[model samples]
Target: MALLITKRCINCDMCEPECPNQAISMGDEIYQIDADRCTECVGHYDTPTCQQVCPIDNTIIIDPQHIEAREALWEKFVVMHHPV
Candidate 1:
């Protein structure tokens, strides 16, 4: 599933550069994730780069309705301009 960024983001810009998909971006007040571009770091790394760099725990989670198979997620990211 795609990951979602909560309002707890501190706008530190820490997570943005860590995102392999370039899915995370600076929002008006917090960071936002573009689901279409997010791959949860499926292929590029062993874990989600954004989550690892996130200072706020639990800020990123699987989108219940957008559950995606790991392989499919990797494929999607591979097709995009993102790294994952």
Candidate 2:
């Protein structure tokens, strides 16, 4: 699933750089994750890099509305980084 940065984010600037897909960015008030570019680190790591490094608890959580299967996440990863 794509990740969502909650309002609890402290803007520590940790999650943005850790995102393998470049999915995290500064929003109007907090960090935001781009659903289209997020692959949950499927092609790059065993876990989501942003979530792993996030200092604030519950700051990064799965977007329930944008949930995806492992296969779908893998496909997204390939299409994003290995586009034709």
By TM-score, who's the top model here? 2
Residues 13-60 of candidate 2: C-alpha lDDT, one tens digit per residue: 998998889999899999899999999999999999998899988889
Worst 10 residues of 1 by lDDT: 75-84
How many clashes in each structure? 0, 0
Q: How many Å off is the CA of 68 in candidate 1? A: 1.0
Off by over 4 Å in 2: none
Candidate 1's C-alpha lDDT? 0.83
lDDT of 1 by residue, 1-84 (tens): 888888777787888888877888887888888888888888788888888887888887787767888888978977885554
* lDDT at position 40, candidate 1: 88
Candidate 1's error at 80, in angstroms? 1.8
lDDT for residue 6 in candidate 1, whole number 0-100: 82
